[model samples]
Target chain A: MKSARPDSQGHFGPYGGIFVPETLMEPLRELTRVYKVAQKDPAFKKELDYYLREYVGRPSPLWFAQRMTAQLGGPKIYLKREDLNHTGAHKINNVVGQALLARRLGKTRLIAETGAGQHGVATATAAALFGMECTVYMGKVDMERQALNVFRMESLGAKVVAVTAGQQTLKEAINEAMRDWVSNLRNTHYVLGTAFGPHPYPMIVRDFQSVIGKEARKQILKAEGRLPAAVIACVGGGSNAIGIFSAFIKDEGVRLIGVEAGGLGIVPGKHAARFAGGKVGVLQGTKSYVLQDDDGQILLTHSVSAGLDYASVGPEHAMLHDTGRAEYTYIEDADAVAGFDQLAQWEGILPALESSHAIAWVVKNAGQFAKNDIVIINVSGRGDKDVQQIAEWKKGQSTK
Target chain B: MKKTRVDQKFAALKKQGKKGFIAYIGAGDPSLDDTVDIVLRLEEAGVDLVELGLPFSDPLADGRVNQDAAARALEAGATFDGVMNCVAKIRERSQIPLIFYAYLNTLYARGFEKAMNEAAAAGIDGFLILDMPREESGPYRKFISAASLNSIVLITPTTPEERMKQIVKDASGFVYCVSREGVTGVRDSIAEGARGLVGKIKGHTRLPVALGFGIGTPPQAAEAASFADAVVVGSAIVNKFHNNPHTPEGRADAAAFVAEMVKAVKAVNSPL
Candidate 1:
């Protein structure tokens, strides 16, 4: 069945059109054309499926969090075990797909921009598996906090370039990666880390990630004999959220919820909640809800989770918010930390700080759902990468 | 469409049988007032047109030099209103053709029509939005033409001949032919692909071509002017006086450097 969105020009309603310079227009067009062809090729599908199932370990489990469900005393919570995947995150799913497409496009080198460094590690893994040269741009601040992931990327044989531009965060890293891609368009394929860039990218990344939803939908039906009342995921650039939401979009009875980083509070410069504090504007390459001031200068964003620290959300998320298909809300840093600790102690599973935002929302709103209601939260990644950062945060909190 | 100052200046250059020299400077580099001084100084040094860069938070098409200039501008309190006010002040002294080199978000945030109207009211002659390609320029083109401002289009070395035909269909003012495949920066010598790109654009539209990107030195500017109708020098001039004291001597020194570029471009006599 053909989906009704993106209209060939890659617009989801009024969002997600190409907004890059003339130098990249031709290359983007070529990529779009090539991706369209690859989607229908049987050999392409067989190769991608083989790698995803055999190498990356597809069909991650859907475990019922009985302790959390009993303690919360509201919804029956089910956690999607994406953390069980190879590399301990869901990012490998999209990276492996793009790497295969890159090989098909006849390009050699791979470039990426990372925030918490999960995407960088995933890209590096794929590049090494495929015997391709890889480079990743990461903000200086992120490189300091997510040092382990940075080392992991280097250990995978990827060159990590530290970006020291504005705010020294994900936004600046994306800017640096774009500069590199512009300079090396001939031999390099930019493996965008999120579902937020110009056309074809948002669509391409979302399609690659939809496997999470496809698996969860079937698993829930067999496990519970019905669809979950709500499906929850955290929104960074919204790749995983859109991934799980894509399968349930047409199910009218199923509610989709996306949680954003509320940071310290709703105050300006203290949060990364685009739907809460942002207006519709163009940034990076796509038109979407962006955190900006009155004069359109992109605002600085703050999140305890480096993965969720961004000024803009994906364009499709903007469309979903406007069309009222999904309910969006924010989770503060303190609450997210609480969620992180709660999930570890109660469920015996460590979740990435980014995924804790979704858990935080459910913990804060436990009374909103009925006790029989089934709700699934996507465990996007494991917390092994965030252990030191959270330990330091806890030490500082105790001192305070 | 009515002839804008940009069109008139290009026609005037054609009549004088000399190539045009276009100068680019970030508004409010140190302050908005200093931008006025720079524009007037470049005008006095024989610049036929000026491309005023509107500061954006994330400039994907710019290199380190232009990016740093934007950072300085934003740090010096450069806003949309401040930049328009600077243009109004320049109109108080000179009539040199002026255009905005901007990204789509800066104007889209203020409402494209309202932004264009305000700019035209403040004496901006045209716009060269770096990221708005032909496919996404439908409504933007209408807004520019409705405001009676020239919608300047860019044709890069990577743009194929078939795509170039579609890009220059309704292009006004003059076509900007990028001298290289990369973002805005300085290079050692002119790329051989620039001449072919210009020739291809000429086949599509009668609009005068202005070659930019990496044309920073006087000899490079002269070489670019040998084939194109205009030569745009941005990063070299920006890097030259970027750290000078914001005094009369500083403005004069910047103007002296630009004057050498003007002399080089004007010395190139070629049939258009």
Candidate 2:
């Protein structure tokens, strides 16, 4: 067997590694070994391809936003519409892959933590399909905010446990999930929502989700007759961004831009912009650029989008930032709100709040690109869930 | 004096031919004063060690019961300093080993080095940062060792063999082995995998390995003790606090519940 060295050890340029207890060592090692073998199996690939093509509606269109691009007078903006997927987001692509691997490993139950409910719903959907018992952990505050998704998950036959601890959000939910996994290791498989967590998880989730980039690569070339000058995706735990960027990483000329949530502003304790204001630290099973206080405690992060409110970016994104393979930037809440309004008014599309961070960045820099340059923005999910919050925020703004 | 305490407790358990029972409770669950009383009660009930859970807004590894305890503790105005003071109060009455169970952020917010120093001074015997494991133990371990405070590491059934060896090498006091994968709760039976897991860990080091997460009754503790050096009961005891639902009477009721569990543990461990 090829050694599970280098990547499995969690040393992604000081970003990733196993920071878990001694109890989790065997399961994680077993997972690493199984996943490594499954990745190369033609049958696994064929099965995943079937799911992508038949179930998820893969090869989602790459459409040029003509009106917006013409108005900006910088470049033609194109969108990779992952929102068109069956679950209305790119999250299911990764969940389906991981769930299959879990079954192969003989795990009978599925557990996950959610921020925006996208990953939770996707996991629940997969679990129901695969006949696995599913449990999802969400912060109490998130359970209240994303009530519709709670119903959706429950309807899909999954138990939604409310985590009331810590910032009452995604990070805390993840911690609760980890604790759950530690206690239920016998028949349970933790379907991590993103490309973060301990070693192999970051690498494994990214590899599974990379189908986004793989399909986008072929479609973009077919549509535009050439590869675009840039690819942009919003980064939370950075699964979507990495998924789209991985296929293009070897392409020398394609610039990858990952936009992080810059809630209110970059002022300390106000945002989740790990690259903009965070420092190196260990958090939630991995070492990455974490938004922490001087004492190294993770600070409470704020963002208009629940999905993007994470203190730590994915390890690979941190590695990418350090290696200069990708440029990381931040988009403030006001700017993202503006992008949401513009996308709704101009393109007849409502982007997920998480994806709006990328649109905000694109809108802010659109004037800089040459008119002939082509840019592809990953429209990660549909924004229906954000309508209520956005409307409330706008109403508050109008009243003020 | 420190050496004497460790030696005496070790000797006591050795003579009993059974592992010790460590019970965890959220400090200041219903109120600070009541939490102090509960700790003393637990110690008197024959608990070998008492784990004082420092309430934080975000306790990542806890189940709903423990999460509610932390919330109530925070609601009762249990800050990091307040918890430290509670530990100080517990120190006045008990010499039973005390471990502070918390997330790394709380310690990090107070500054790890400062937190370790203050915790040691507060009469804390050990520290268990729930979210931090052996892989990120560098600074945390060094600071804890410098303060002469034991850093108890958790071992899970899923932990890899090589990493388990590494964890055993770095662990102090004893190793906390999670019996299952999900969060803390009272289950009907010990997981089938835990016996083999204890055997694997025993092959690694001489450090006392304590089985935790699902142990709730005397029989469960005794069953686990047959193979392990200690058994930990947390959520089961915390559930006692919930029976009263945040009332002063509830807190008192919770203390009585710990006393009952301690009685159960002692029944199994006591020489006939």
Candidate 3:
């Protein structure tokens, strides 16, 4: 009867809480209550399932990377192809679930915070499908670096607001989104794109995204006739990693590893390696490990992949890390770029720089596994959104 | 029993047939010395209590004025120790009931038990952490209550009746009744529903309820005091400092602005 979760008050051990303003406490509590009712409603379940299959193109394939296994000379790497999902990232799964709830709540607008724009695109896509107005708050700097995603999000009918606040990154984006939610709580639903934030958000997002792990578990059993030896995914706010890892945490034989962005190195502001540089503190509502300074200001984070650049991980991840249920490690930005190139060359699959973090970990530790052992990597997003940035990065490197 | 400063102030205000008025300002707006100067000036201006806002990088619940003041403080070398040091200076000069108006991350980052002890030792009489809800406030409440510091709770218009009961049950100091359904800012009119919300909270707890968030002008604060036991003026005072340069001149300007607000608050008929 062991359950690793956010408890009744939405705490996962010392992490996770409804740390919000009084204006938001009611909404968070209400959302938590409604989400519980929605879970048991047969009609609600049917509608969610229908949209998951028809609208989002769910049950994304589990592909075996034959060439990658041969090149690495280790365990068979099974790719749980989340990149094949309709919005090109696993972000769509959570967005679709939240959109359904928004519709039920009679919300007319759906708002979100985006970093690399994958979540914005996914949120925008779901908003369009649900015929709800969408606004996305992104850091001004992020909007510039992720211009293509900005365009894609705009094209999908979301109003992309450039936040010119502190640090101008995902952290600021979230702050802006929270401000928006506080002002327009009645008619709006802030579709937080990750498995962070306060109560119900972490729980709701994890439940929606558990499909990845559930699907991969059945698919892996069929492909290898047994559970994989390990499961790996990149951890930002830890949505995708938790999505895949939730299904495997109980399986004692299955090793769960979350790869964090190592950026340049562990020199203070050089990385988003929360496990390496973070201290246990609260930020963005939930109590988790955070990269903060002595003055309690959240420090600027660095990751070549915009999506993986975050100061904190999910509360559940904090709990897991504390209990020794999951091991989190780091992959530097240069190594992730190298992994991106390797995946493209070997498997003809250009991985998103975010997902490439997991791939980098896979290649670095391939020697640790046996030939028959299997390791499944959750390729969280397609690389079309990253190609322009990657090309620009290469140009900058050549000039150097 | 060592009556906490918050309780003593409310009781005295109650006996005097006066409505409470708490003035909020960032601890290091422009510089720490100005902050110490401003709090002392605020006491002279008739502010019953001072809520010294400790700035954080991400102030999610603040409006532009408060946010800008925080930015200025942070830019001017504001740190946790620095703000606390400023509070210690203010304590030496005055005993106006002082509360550290801050976010959960700022306090939690400082460590729960340590924050309570240091806050108390540094002359903070109470706390109104902007983010930590009652459910997550167990450790915070435990530590602060044991140290005999007031742990104020925030209540809003949207709070369900059942949840409000739960929130007030654990509430030690007065409940902060949000005057409007928005972040902290200056508004021409208070929430039209302010009176009813105050009445609802009054039914739940005997602790004095202070309405804040958008109670900007003197008339607005007066209107709010007509119903609630206290009216809070934060952003408007912060706005005075916000619009001016973060200098001694700016601090003087904001202090003058707070004086006007105090005059108006002092004029309010004490319904309590």
Which candidate leads in TM-score?
Answer: 1
| Runs with alpha carbons beyond 4 Å of true place in candidate 1 | A1-4
Candidate 2 per-residue lDDT over residues A1-400, each given as its tens digit: 1111235486677668876655565677788988988988999989988888898888788878988787678688998899889888999999999998998899999999999999999999999999999999998888877788889999999999997666789998898788888777889999998999887788888987898898889988887799888899999999999999999888868999999999989988799999999888777777789897654556789888889999998988888898788999989888899998888787989999889889889899986677889999999998987888888878888999
Instruction: Give the Cα RMSD of candidate 3.
Output: 1.8
If you assessed candidate 1 against the hidden native complex, which CAPRI class would it receive? high
lDDT tens readout by residue for model 3, B32-140: 9988888887888789998888898889999878888898899999998888889899888898999888897887777878988888899888888889877777767
lDDT of 1 by residue, B159-242 (tens): 888898988886899999988878889999999878888888888899999999998889999999988999998988788769
For candidate 3, the chain B TM-score comes to 0.95
Q: Tens digits of per-residue lDDT for model 3 on A101-201? A: 98888899999999989999999999898799999999998898889999999998899999988878998899889999999998999999888999989
Clashes within 3 Å, all models in order: 0, 29, 0
The lDDT values for all models are 0.92, 0.83, 0.88
Q: Which stretches of candidate 3 lie over 4 Å from their true place?
A: B245-250
Q: Score the docking of each candidate (DockQ).
A: 0.81, 0.41, 0.74
lDDT of 2 at B147: 81
User: CAPRI verdict on model 2?
Assistant: acceptable
| TM-score of each candidate structure, all chains considered together | 0.98, 0.85, 0.97
